[model samples]
Every structure is written in C-alpha cells, then in structure tokens.
Target: MFFYLITVLLGLYLGCVGMQLVYLVFIFSKTGQYHRERGSLPAGSAPAEPKPDFSAGVSVVVCARNELDNLRELIPLLLQQDYPDFEVIVVDDRSGDECYDFLLLEALRHERLRLVRVNETPQHITPKKFALTLGIKAARKAAILLTDADCRPVSNQWIREMARTMEGDKEIVLGFSPYQVKNGWLNFFIRYETFYTAVQYLS
Candidate 1:
C-alpha cells in the first residue's frame, strides 16, 4: 500500500511538470507566430503614407559602452544612411576600452557624427537610459530615433520609411528590430525566443 502511494505521488508530480512544459511550449509557439506576422509587413508599409513637402530633421542616438568592434561596423552603416538632414549622436558611457577613442576618430572623419563622453555615471541606475536622455537633449533635430551600438538599418531608405510614418501630432514612433543570423544552436534558440517575444509584444 505504501509503495503504491509513493508511486502515485511521483506520477502526479511528473504529470504536473509535463503539463507546465506543454503550456510553455504552446505559449512560445503562439508568440513566434505573432512576431513573424508582424515583422513580415511589406517594406515601407509599416509607416503611414508620406506627406508632400514634409521634411523633418532627424537625430539618431546611439549609446555605447565597451562596444568598439560593433561601433566600427555600425557607425559606418549609420553614416551611409541616405537621410539628408540627420545627425548621429554617439554617447560614450565611461567605457574602459578604446570605444571612445575610435568614436573620436570617426567623428573627425564624419561631420554628421557627434560624440559625447559621460565621465561620471549618473545616480539614476540606468546608464543607457540616462545617456539616451542626454543625447535627445543635445539633439538639434526634432525627431529622435533611438538605436543601439550593435544595431544597423537594413538599407539607406530606412530613415525615409521611418520618418514617413510620423505624421500628425504623434510623439512616439515604435519600429521593429530583427536579430541577425548567427551560428550555433544556442544562437538559434535565442533568436527564436526573441522573435517569439517580439511577436507577442509588438503584434
């Protein structure tokens, strides 16, 4: 009788764990479907129709800390954007590496690229958020586009597509960000997880 009772308890625990796993899988699948659908929007369709003679200034803010390699790749891509009246602001958050130095060199080469050095960390706890706020305040343009050190626009027309959607009195413009392909099963799983989450939140 005691043996049977022990067996039943073990079976119940395993069954509960199995159910939880199945539930998680179902949630993840649904999330992935949503993200794929949202991100699959036709190019230039995500934003609203463009207005005539509506040219607005844009400020691209990039917050960096110990991202020298990524900066080297990302900065050039940003500089190559086809936007006629846009400025790139790179905020260096007290990086211990040569990221700031590289940025300084890039700034010298590119007139549109501006560098800001944050010598002391702020008390607010979120360094990236603080850096972004500073960038926005220093921005000369009215429209602000926030991106990361590791991210880059897909093409030169990315700005035009993003800007066209900001008509009327809209203050905030949220866009989709997709992950790049990487080797290894871990990376695949991570990207899958990210896609799933984006689908759930964005869609």
Candidate 2:
C-alpha cells in the first residue's frame, strides 16, 4: 500500500512539471507570432524622410566594469564605426580588472576614443547607472547612443539607420539585437528562450 502511494505522488509531481513546461511553450509560441507580424511592415509604409540638413555630432557611450575580455573584442569595433562625426566614450566604473589599462591603450590608438574612469564609489547608487549618467553629462554631441561593452554593430550603416530614423519629435527608436548561435540542444533551448523574450517585448 505504501509503495503504491509513493508511486502515485511521483506521477503527480511529474504531471505538474510537464504541464508547466507546456504552458511556457504555448506562451512562447504566441509571443513569437506577434513579434513576426509587427516586424514585417513594408518599407514603403515607413514615415517620409526629413529634409536634408547636416547634423555632424553624435556620442556613443559604453559602460564597463571588470570587462577586459569584452573591451578587447568590442573597442576596435566601436572605434571603427563609419560615422563621420562622433566620439566613443568608455566609462569605467572602478573596474578591478585590466579593462582600464586596455582602454588607455586603445584610446591612444584611436583618436576618437575617450576614457572616463570613476575612481570612487557613489554614496548610494548603482555603479552602472551612475557611470551612464556621467557619460551623458560629459557627452559633446546632441545625440547620445548607449551600447553594452559586449555588443558590436552589424554594419557601417548602423549609425545611418539610427540617425535617419529620428525625425519629427521622435524621442525613442526601437532596435533589435540578434544573438550568436552555438551547437547542441542547449543552444536550441536558449534560442527558443530568446525568441520568446523578443516576442513578449515586441508584442
């Protein structure tokens, strides 16, 4: 009798777990469908282009803390952005790693690159947010673009697309970042999870 009771409880637990997984799958599918529909608008349906006026200034701010590996990979990409008139500001939030040193070296190599190191901690604030605020305050351009240290733009036209999209009192522009794919079942699961997240946000 006791063996039969234990078997029944185990089956019930398994059933609940299975049900939860099914619910999550259902939610993900719905979200992906919505994102696809919204993202598929025709190019001609976009807003009309604004009059040609030369806007030469832009500032790209990146916040980092103990991100040596990421800095090594992304700094060159930032410096190489095809934007004609822009500055790249890397705000180092008291990184204990060698990222600061790396930034110094890269700054010397790239005239457009600037480094801002915060040596002291804020009394009561998040370091990343504080660093970003400082970067914005110190920016020399009217337009400020924020990106993570690990991120890289897909092409030279990234800035062009972003700049052209801003017209007629548009305050915010939505952008999408694609994730790198890897091998195995875990990668498949992660991709599915990312798709689900994008769906929720886009919807």
Candidate 3:
C-alpha cells in the first residue's frame, strides 16, 4: 500500500511538471510573435472593415509615491517615446521626496508633461489607487497607458506598439513587464518568476 501511494504521488508531480514544460515551450514561446502580428490580417484573407486608429492620442499615466529617483530616470525616457500625440501624467501621492518639485520643473519645460499633486489620502483609501484615479481623471486623451515609475520602456516605440494592438474591439490590452537583469542568484530567480507569471497571465 505504501509503495503504491508513493508511486501515485510521484506520477502526479511528474505529470504536472511535464504539462508545464510543454506549455512553456509551445505557448509561451509565441507571445512575442503574437505581439508582432497582432494587428496584421491573415495572408490571404479578404480585407475587413477598417479599425479605428488609437494612436492618434494617448495619455501615459504614472502613479508615484516617494519615487523621486526612479521618476527622474524614467520620465525622460517616457517623454522621448516616438508617438506623435501623447501626454505623460505623473501623480505625486504625498511624496516626502523631491518628486513634486522635479515634476513641476519638468512640466514647465515640456508642454506634453502634466503633473497631478496629491497632498493627502483619506485613511480608508489606498494611496496608489487614489493617485492613479486622479491621474487618469486629469488625462485629456482618449487612451490611457499605465506604467510604473520604476519601469523603463525597452523601445522608444512602446506606445506605438501598444496602440497598434488596440485597433480592433479590444477594450483592454495587457503588457509584459520584465525586470532588469542582475548578477545575483536572487535576481535570476526573480526574473524567472516574473517571466513565468507573464507567461501564465499574458497568454
């Protein structure tokens, strides 16, 4: 009886692992290709009605709470996105750091940058959610793009790529956010976990 139980448990574990391996190899590997071909029609298919152009205007929203350093580095990269008509809105959620001052200066210099200052959050409300709400409300564009202050876009055409995927009836578009590579074992583990989560969710 004991031997039979051990064998059954081992088989279950191995089956789960095998299924996960197959999924990673076959399905997860296609994520990049799907992103690349999202808006394209099939090779020989008849032309369908034209989809709406979502890239005409977009609002890039960032909710920050005491994230001055990350914002300082990230804001410049966001401002440099290749999209023609877009605005970057940063919500300062009662930050104790110099984030508010920095955003104020940047907003003055760049007409495309907008700042929403959150002085305080109610006791019952979450700060990040509140900040994001304010930022989205302040947005003047039809499309809202959300990114974290700590994240850096891998390409200047990030907005363009995302907007392209929204051409059809898709109301919500999910994106992948990979962590920066580092030399430590923990970093490697974190990156792997992040990639795995992206695989499961993005697929």
Candidate 4:
C-alpha cells in the first residue's frame, strides 16, 4: 500500500512540472511572434496610407545633467534627424560643466534647436523630472518624442518613425534600447535584466 501511494505522488508532481513547462513555452512563442510582427517590415511593402505629414511637427526632448560627453556626441545626431518641421529641446539641469555654453552655441547654429537652462532643481522634485517638465513646457510642437542624451537612434528615420506611429489612437509608443553586449557576467546580467523588464511589461 505504501509503495503504491509513493508512485502516485511522484506521478502527480511530474504532471504539475510538465504543465508549467508547457505554459512557459506558450508564453515565449507568443512574445516572439508578437514582436516579430510589430518590429519588422514585409518585403516590398509600402505603408498603407501616407504617413502623417512631417510638417505637422515633432519635439524631441532631452534632459541632461553633467552629461557633456554624451551631449557632445549625440546633439549632432539629433539635429540631423531626417524629418522636417521638428525641434530638438535640450534642458541643462544644473550641469556644473560647460554644457550650458555648448548648448547655447548649438542653438545659435541650428534654428530648430532650443536650449533651456535650469540652474537649480526645486526643493522637492528630482532634477531629471524637473528638467523634463521644463523641456516639454518649452516645446513648440504638439507631438513630443523623448530620449536620453546617452542613447543614439538606430537610424536617421527615428523621428519619422515615431511621428508616424503617433498617428490616430496611439498616444504613447514604447521602444526598446539594447545595450552593447560585452564579454562579462555584469554585462550579461544587465542585458538579462533589460529583456526581463521588457517581458514583465509585455506580460
């Protein structure tokens, strides 16, 4: 009688484990399929309708704090986006370095580049949030696209893609940024966490 009971319990545990494995596989397949559909373009296909006119305008906002190095490298890329009637706003949030002067120079150079200087953060709010608010408030365009100063767009069409996606019923578009993979456990962990966060949000 004891031997029979042990065998039945073992079988039940294996059945539960098998079901969980099946569930995980189902979720994994669904996620890959969804992203593959959303993130890729079919061969020789044109957009169904004309994309929203670039003349409608877009504001690309970036809030920086002591990121002179990143700003130097990225501002040119932002200014060079292949979209018409768009503005790039960079808010200098208490950056102790020469960021203010650098942006001031850039603004003079580019008619569409606007610079807002924040010498101090308010008593209660975080610096990043404060700077972002100021940038958005100063934006000239109704549609706003935001990105970090440390990040670069994969293509010159980044602004165009974002502006087009915002058309009709889509208020916010979520994008994925992948870090450069390196040969180290720490890098591996960071990449894992990034994908894990994306999956968590997707779920």
The prediction achieving the highest TM-score against the true structure is 3
What is the full ranking by lDDT, best candidate first? 3, 4, 1, 2
**lDDT of each residue in 22-114, candidate 3, tens digit only:** 987888777765644447668898766545475569999999988999998999999999888899999998889899999999999999999
Model 3 regions lying over 4 Å from their true place: 1-55
- For model 1, residues 1-203, the per-residue Cα lDDT tens digits are 99999999999999999987886677646544644322456777664443623378899999999999999999888888887799999999889999988999989999999999888867866887888778888899879889999888899887777887687787987776878889999889988887766755654
TM-score of 1: 0.74
- Which residue segments of model 1 deviate by more than 4 Å? 1-54
lDDT of 1 at 28: 41
- TM per model? 0.74, 0.70, 0.77, 0.76
Model 4: ten consecutive residues of lowest lDDT: 29-38
User: Best by lDDT, which number?
Assistant: 3
Superposed Cα deviation of residue 193, candidate 4 (Å): 1.5
TM-score attained by model 3: 0.77
User: What lDDT is obtained when candidate 1 is compared to the true structure?
Assistant: 0.83
The root-mean-square deviation over C-alpha atoms between each candidate and the true structure, in angstroms, is: 5.7, 5.3, 4.5, 5.6
Off by over 4 Å in 4: 1-52
Ranking by TM-score: 3, 4, 1, 2
Question: Which residue pairs show backbone clashes in model 3?
Answer: none
Error of 3 at 179 (Å): 1.2
Model 3 lDDT at residue 202: 77
